[model samples]
Target: MANELMIFAVITALLALIFRFTSLIVNSRRNRKKAVAFFHPYTNDGGGGERVLWCAVKAIQEESPDLDCVVYTGDHDASPQSLMDRALDRFGVKLLYQPKVVHLCKRKWIEETTYPHFTMIGQSLGSVYLSWEALCKFTPLYYFDTSGYAFTYPLARVFGCKVICYTHYPTISLDMLSRVRQRSSSYNNDALIAKSVWLSRCKIIYYTLFSWMYGIVGSCAHLAMVNSSWTKAHIEQLWGIPDRIKRVYPPCDTSGLQALPLERSTETPIIISVAQFRPEKAHTLQLEAFSIAMKRLNGGKPKPKLQFVGSCRNKSDEARLQKLKNKAVELNVDGEVEFHKNLMYRDLVRLLGGAVAGIHSMTDEHFGISVVEFMAAGAIPIAHSSAGPKMDIVLDEDGQQTGFLACTIEEYSDAILRIIGMSETERLTMAAAARKRAKRFSEQRFYDDFRAAIRPIMCLPYRNSNDVISNRDTDEERVCTTLYTVCGAAISNLFEAIHKHCVRAVQRGESSSLSWLGLRRAEYGCFVKFSRLLQLNEFLYKVSKCGKIFCWSFST
Candidate 1:
């Protein structure tokens, strides 16, 4: 009796799922307005990622005014008007379209507090849950992730939304695996792992497994865009998707910076570092390097002053800034170091124009927009000798070095000393070259590349639109249907095999017919796999129920 009841409940649930899915298909065929939904938790954060989000939205709005845009944000305190104002004030970007903001309460799961240890794996799993929440709230024709959350792609696809991801940096890649395996004395490898053999082995295993999982998740995206050549290489290697990743340089406000006077005041050389106060930015290295450079210039030469201009997103960032100040005092360069947090756009432009050179110490920075801005403002750049600066930005087309690259504090000090000692004519020549290189990553170029990359996907007709279905969507639907059909057929074949084996065993007058089948292990494995499939189906059913409740609430 219990077995019969269980079977009945399973059948009923399956029937309900089928009914709901059929209803959704019918609803999709209706003439509804289509929109692209952008999933970014911290849209108001004044960072490069925010710049990409706003620019992409603006580009889409300008290019196609018919389609609407909706942004899923975690910033619930700010209204649409305030967000628009902040965007304009911080980045000089104007968003003509007022996108609907859907506040997500579960976004805290992605924050560092949720994962004080093992942040990478924790945030990744958290993003999957966040994506599910976004989907349950509203289903869009296209799902776009400006942030580096590739884990959301599969969830988007399961809901029949095309997935597009702009990967600022890959979460896991070969370089990360190599760093763990080799136990190198670099920022990528932990000091404990590098020192202990057992810890190093365990970390290597951890990174290798995570890399495989990352690749699997990354391959689910239909299209991927990266910010720099270094990012593009890593994405292509780890994403395991051929010809899906393209390079679209992040937008930089070059015109405004370029309009500033090229000639800087030589009375007191100002060395500026325009980056967020994050541990990865290596502000400590900048302080130590500046101290060493000052010591080198003590031979009857005026010391250059270092200015740290950056955005502070939260209390942690503010605390980091204070700690950096303390470090400067420890180095006895506090008198020469100045910290500027969240400077206005105009003030930042003015500072950049008056500065002689810019310094960046982040390792493997994925496309240094600040470095590009420094160049556009006629400040020669001295950046870390890896990633974006090494592969894309600082190199000249004619095989000339546009700026300086350093790996160590001493190297950074020597580079700064060399820049300080250079003739004004040489400095001007280098600045001109750097500015010319930066123009390639201008806002216009970014718009063009972004449009080209997304055009093929966005132009496809949505299911809810009155327009006829494009070949791409039709092909995708056919492929998805065939996949389901194939899976169903495989399950049927497995059951049939078990049935035939059981019949043959019973006909031979064997009491233990299950053992006679010689397929108990295979049958158990199949049952486990099928059970997982049912659990996934059940989860999707619950999500669909939530979506229905939301839709009903909005309609009433």
Candidate 2:
């Protein structure tokens, strides 16, 4: 009887392994056939959103060969040496860059280095044309909004393509509203009018308007994707778009972050921070907190050494880093604080592994990748109490905090001090908890979520007939087409004002003024030519916008 029982248990275990393996294979197969076209504004810069876009493309390509992952982007003239190019290769996604985008990148460089007044007419014009071309070519384009919008949306619609956007944050919020109002006060009286005018015309106004507009487009999509639940709710509430918003958190490439079991050589503590040198990141706060912590913890022994590792791309970022260095000296923590840039990934990871804790000072960091990187490397995270990092990722079993969350300078300082004073066992426990928590956000989870979201959209029926424009048409068809072209163009041009800088000064979001002014002259010319067109009243009614000609009814 004992021999038979042992044989039976071995057979059952074998069967279970087979079942699990089969399930994984089936899921992998399912994830592989979704064709997705990604629209990235700049082909050059390697920012966080760009990273997300590339990861999704690479995952799709690896798992599903038939799933066409076409990347439509503005050319940034970025070479293999360029940071973005390296990331793109690391993911294995093919790229399609437009000349206009390249020119835009060139113009940005010029604006940065040489001429401050470089309007970049070529860049803007190239963007519009490329967008128009992308719309005409690609069927279902997914827009990633790290770059500006005005050029991308209208073209996508003209071609009858669906758009899904991964918005980092809502452009218009309580924060932006206050800023717009404050700026509008400087404009000649008519505070409400000026505010409204600025809001409608300005960059922020355009951003907010485009976000809501894109939300409408996102709703129309077979799928609406976002990074966090916080962003999902904000999009739904603000846009009032009745769509299914799916949460697919982007992944961090944490291939080899497991503990190496190497001995840490330092007798004193080590705290390190890794982020781009930016004012918004509030690296100064980390320095301030560290200064206080070191002073309090100092007992005639060598104090903890703090390292700041990150690159400075812009002048403002470089300036901020310099300012922080100065402040660190003033606080008398100059000897403890060290700033280094452009460190290799392995080196950074090794540093993280040796560190007692990692510091993050950025407020409301949307889905903190660096914090997770630190966690994966077994660094206990001491982060600001912000939206993405606080609510989404850092949580432990039994409802305990995974690591420290601080808001005020004193609170931040105290948290660092407390961590420093922790017993070795307590520190180890916190590090373990952080690592466990970060496991959920691994590359596998990201791949699974993204695959599921994209699968349905890929299965959508290809309606080639409706999208194609034929030369022959009936009188009624001609009239409808005319109306569509005239009205569509008018509305699109009106909306394009949301992207212009002049409009950013006004607080009102995307006012009719810019649209109206543009159409006024066009309307007069159209009135003379309307008699020769196929549909007169039908054309007039559809094209007319408050006595101005609205041309968008053309069938393409």
Candidate 3:
């Protein structure tokens, strides 16, 4: 009996020590300088996402000049001046000041090759570790995630930072679940997995579980900014924080493109395709459609030259580009198809100036910035007939058709043929309308909307809230969230429901609102704050039900 008491005393002392240590990490929130840290692991990808990062940094610099801007990147060669120059030279976005860089070493963990089987969950969890490396090095007043890494937000909250993320698209969605259930082979679902019923069922279950965890972690963000209408809806449904979600269009470089003339040169009509060479972009589909279009011409009409222009982000992308070149050769349209990789803004503009139309074939693209760019450049877009293009961009402008939307390869080929057959007057008329429609997604509009969304959160106090709504957690507050929340019942998403329960319980005059330091006398024997719940899943559900005691609660 004496030994049992001694063991109990040791356990109590251990919990106290851990609680104090976690509190120090949580309470040490204030930085010497008021700074904003943008968590973007890959900064030199030269994609639309990278453009967004630079534009966002520039916007923040303008909004609050006193706040220092820092970019957490994995690129070893990246410097303040180099990134600034890339922004200007590549995307024509000029930064007011250089952002401080924090180099990350654990980037490999987030790479797709690291976990070939469970890539989605692998990368999601990997991002949490990467964020850990980033935040430990420099604790900022505001933690901004330009890249869509939802899993890292909870850890950032634990470090007492106000988390904000500009989500391009949801990490998981009903569409993914549907695709798996239907056994459809797409970018994420493997053809092999789709063929086997058992495999498909197993994957569906895995996705459902991951979706729940993703929703929980994603809710930790103080503000969630989405890029498109499609993106907004998915994030709203998935994260279950519709109140905090804001729909902001991505910054399209329309201002510069709008300056180009609508009239294409009398040379061969060029059809340009611009997007990163990722699997989902469907570069092969564009190539196949172009090949069919070329065959259909057969000396009857002038065959338009197809131009493939984009950047390769990694080895997989580089390999994909090479495979595309090989595919062009195999398709016998090698001579007709031209590949121009990583072209500068001026070069791309020059190509856009000569192009009669642009082709995009990615299905369910959240927001097609490239499609908008195509329209802004006076190129009638032939885009996929779903998501961003169909819902937002490729609609009637001033009572006239602005662009074409296609689903199948045959439909895309037909659109190409129609564009080639159009008279100069007809082409110019449509191009003019498309450009007018494109003006809505301009860089200035993004800056205005983005500034408005972040302003309220930037001014919020670093005070504790049971939900991941406000800002910093107090000394014991973070320990409860990180240790207990992770281990106990109020894991981010759990906090909001638990808080609401406690608030209702208190209003009923049943129980007092609780905190990490608060415990009901006699009924609760030990200082069992959430950071110490062993049977967290079971206990948390009871806590959510407002069962007598031990639930962490907040007034607001």
Q: Considering every candidate listed, which one attains the maximal lDDT?
A: 3
Using TM-score as the yardstick, the better of models 2 and 3 is 3
For candidate 2, give the lDDT. 0.57
lDDT of 2 at 198: 50
Ranking by lDDT: 3, 1, 2
User: What TM-score goes with each of the models?
Assistant: 0.81, 0.66, 0.82
Worst 10 residues of 1 by lDDT: 547-556
Which prediction has more favorable lDDT, 1 or 2? 1
Better of 1 and 3 by lDDT: 3
Put down candidate 2 lDDT per residue, 1-556, tens digits, no spaces.
2232244335435544644443332233223223455666444343456667767666666655655666565454543335345554433333332111212222342233343222232333445566544444444433333343333444444334445556665533444445554554421223554557554356445545545654453444334567766666666676565355677776765556755432343477788898878656788888888877776775744468889988666676678788988998899889888887756555776777788878898876767777887777777788878767887877674564578888888888888777777777777777777777888777778889888876765556653432222322455456656665676566444334422333342334433433434443345345324423533344334333211111121122
Write the number of the candidate with greater TM-score, choosing between 1 and 2.
1
Report how far off residue 511 is in candidate 1 (Å): 28
Which stretches in model 1 have alpha-carbon errors above 4 Å? 1-33, 185-188, 397-400, 464-556
RMSD of 1: 8.4
| Residue 262 error, candidate 1, Å | 1.2
